[model samples]
Target chain A: MTTITVATRPTEAPAGHRLRFMFADMITVTWRNLLALTRIPEALFFTTLQPIMFVLLFRYVFGGAIPIPGGIPYVDYMMPGIFVQAVMFGAVGTSVGLAEDLQKGLIERFRALPMARSAVLAGRTTADAVRNVFVVLIMTGVAFAVGFRINTTVVDYVLGAALLVAFAYSMSWGFAAIGLAAPNSETAQVMAFPILIPLTFASTAFVPIQALPGWLQVFARHQPVSVVINGARSLMVGGYYHSTSSLWYALLWIAALLIVLVPLGVWRYRKTS
Target chain B: MGANSSIAVDAHDLVKVFPRGHVRALDGVSLEVEAGTILGLLGPNGAGKTTAVRILSTIIGPDSGHATILGHDVVKEADTVRRIIGLAGQNAAVDDYLTGRENIRMVGRLSHMSWKSVGARADELLETFGLTDAGNRVLKTYSGGMRRRLDLAAALVAQPPILFLDEPTTGLDPQSRQDLWRVIEGLVAEGTTVLLTTQYLEEADRLARDIVVIDHGRVIAQGTPAQLKADLGTSVVSVTLADAGTAQRAAVLLAPLSAQPPLVEGATVDLTVDDGPKVAVEVLRSLDSAALSLAGLALREPSLDDVFLTLTGHKAEVANDGGTPA
Candidate 1:
């Protein structure tokens, strides 16, 4: 009964055809984001540039004042801490950009498209992870330039880098979820502060956990930020890798964050009524 | 793709209540659209046009209605329904950062076209929408009309059987509106069924083959333009003048010719008169006696606006673009 005058139009489909359509659509969304970012290479520059500057600044400016246990240099100790923050904060940029998209009604347009429900977020998180890798590499190079040498063998360094990148990649999902759930950009910033500040300051990101107050020390030791920094730092310091407990802790955080944020983000998307 | 289905879109008593019973956005509204013709949905603000469009497009669910787009259920089979329907909103749903070509290509990709096919379709749409020259330029630099055209082009990327236009020309200039109307005509000529919603009377008159007139979330009347106009009781004789009291005196003279009482509104005088042309001349003779400046006179059949005024005792609010949606 379809009186379609055109001879080359599709009229009916099966279930698998639609599922593949969603997958293909997500790949396009990912490419669209990357293409949009190509013009503003500044995000790439800032992500890398800001982290490099911080590592150098903290090393030359305050390295002499702060003493470390076992006399490990501040440059060597502070590099991993700054690296994690730089990458995590890099994710907040994606969150803010997501907030901007919401205001502009871009997200609504995507929802109207019968694409993969999670593809948009997945594409963003994937691209962000790549950005974090480049940013972390810059931070790592600068750390080495400032007399912060990795005492561990080459294999350990690779393992540590892999862990850090994985951690950063996983973190973007939470931030992406926040960007979608946040009512407005200002609220997004407000919400980010409480989550980032407590996680960053309470953990052994900048200093060792034993250096904090009694109540904070307990929290500092168990927090995900502490586990991540210790894990990355342990790989660089060959002597600390004997236990490898920090690596497991970091992985636990990654798994835990993915389980909580990904579904919540997807659920929020479904309710986009 | 239900290109083979005779019924492009069929719905029954679709009702959608937003924010519980306190707000009834769409109250028991339903209509069907045959394949290949443009079915224009005309109503003033809050007429449930957008709500019905949303329900049919599968963007939101109807509380008590069932709809099938090309044989796919709007709710239960949303993915299938979406595959056959394309929607372009009053506000341009485009990403400004991307180029027109890139935006359309992205939509093609989302619709599952291969990258090569996506790029090819993007170019085709860009040329058809008169945006080929601006294809490479970012949408941020495009004019308002170009952005809207590109938005429409993006919606058509999937080649959906049914197109949903929700006030497609709300803010466009006269020239741009005409351009969109042409594009819509082209769509229908190529066998695409359209469910267009608009608040502009002229747009509905120009585009809709069959008009569905809605008010306060219900269809007041549904018919062809001529049929709807004929249902307005009697022809209206409208007169425009340059000087004072011409319309007043004309109303007095035209009173006896009217099936209903004559009405004098501002500078123009209108009367729902029988055999309006015969009565229009009589009105002019009275105005000539007043020695008032004679500007112009128009005697014509009643329009949808007049029908709206006659039925509701007032025109529907023009700007019913509330924050709520169907």
Candidate 2:
């Protein structure tokens, strides 16, 4: 009997030895999603193409109609907001991907494995963040070609881009929760728009805060999306609207969202069918 | 050996009710699989087969009761049990965007294998499952059979001592199912304890040493294939007449030799008999004396279908949708 037990026993790790395993599992899952992105060029094409279209449509088509409040070019003024908007859209892709995995029963497969429970959600959001970074870089290049310039120092521009990516990464957790709650990817995509429309459209992403009605102006200026967009906009192109305090407020928003949504996503994932 | 040590999978009175509508997926289900043996969980669609597998594999917790794999509690020691079990779900849960080799490697890495050995094991599995030629192709481009094979390969990459397969061949072509059965046989030969849930009676008969049949979230019957058939007392005799018109008359003639009345369908007369060959010979002699020209005559042992029908009071195929027969 002892021999049978010895022969069949699974390899046991030392007490509390799973910390490194958790990191490894997370990285492996991240690597898998990233590999998938590379293999499916269409996913990359569509993700990159949408931002390019936004840059073009907002810059050329809506650029003439939209007025710049700070005497700045509409293109430069809108680029920060566009970057935040593009990154937000990119983050929604996380929800879609997660919902697709759930619908396809991939999550059940992951659950049957012995790896870290947090690895699947962590890896998914991390992969989308990495993809968001790439989209931001490509959009930056496109902005540069279209006469969009960073008026501030290079460090500030880099900081602004980093904050945008971080915000996008934080938002991915909220999307993860939505994905786990949603029945399918199509519903996730459709349902995300309602929540996103008020955030992006009502904020300072497209037009100036002054363009909105007086009642909506309060929310338009004070909302987290506006704070982050205005914060990134200040760091990239210095203007009277560039307030240093907004950056801290944006960071606080990102941190608060991560604190709330990470647990919610993981909890939802564990309870998912 | 102690009882727990001898039993690889020991589940007791597991009960799971879905929270939303309170759907009773498992109602006091219990069973055990001995070490290094095969146990087939037989059921129809929605008979809680997948739910039972999920609970035993620790993918989902049971609402009540307990289960253990290799003496490690599925809920309390889920991580340890997970390390020792491999599961191939009904959907063949391999990622579509990954190549067969990459899929195997990913599972190996998740199992905490070193990168070098993971690579080697991936190659070896790809070869073993006959996916070496298509190893580099993304799974979306592979055939359904190829994807199912890849899923099985991924599950086996870590060589877990216990395996749970939930309808592993549900959507597979016949040849692919045969190939998978052969691979599974090889795994059992290597001393892996397997608990497979399948709707196909033949699958259970061919692979499982012990079979447990569940329906409507309860165990309807369980035993070895032969024992189950004998318990049904369903040995049968069939005689085909040269004339379809004579079948009814033959049924009347054969009724006295059978335990129940004979059934005539087209040119054949079927008799429910206890001693098949003896009754078959008796029926033939009577039919010949009556000048009923015989085209064929045979005695047949009871099949799993008869056992299922007798126990459930309905044919297995009829009550197979996990509900009362339509």
Q: Among these predicted structures, which one has the highest TM-score?
A: 2
Lowest summed-lDDT stretch of 10 residues in model 1 chain B?
B317-326
Q: Write the per-residue lDDT of candidate 2 for residues B96-175, one digit (tens) a residue.
A: 99899999999989888889989988888888888889999999999877887888889887888898998777767678
Cα lDDT of model 1 by residue, B32-122, tens digit: 7778887888777776888888788877789897988877788888776666777887777788889999889887777666788778778
After superposition, which runs of candidate 1 have C-alpha atoms over 4 Å from their true positions?
A1-9, A17-23, A45-53, A60-63, A145-147, A240-243, B1-5, B20-22, B240-265, B278-297, B311-326
Give lDDT: candidate 1, residue A249.
84
Off by over 4 Å in 2: A1-7, B20-22, B239-271, B281-297, B313-326
DockQ of each: 0.33, 0.41
Worst 10 residues of 1 chain A by lDDT: A1-10
The models' CA-based lDDT, in order, is 0.75, 0.85
Alpha-carbon DockQ of candidate 2: 0.41
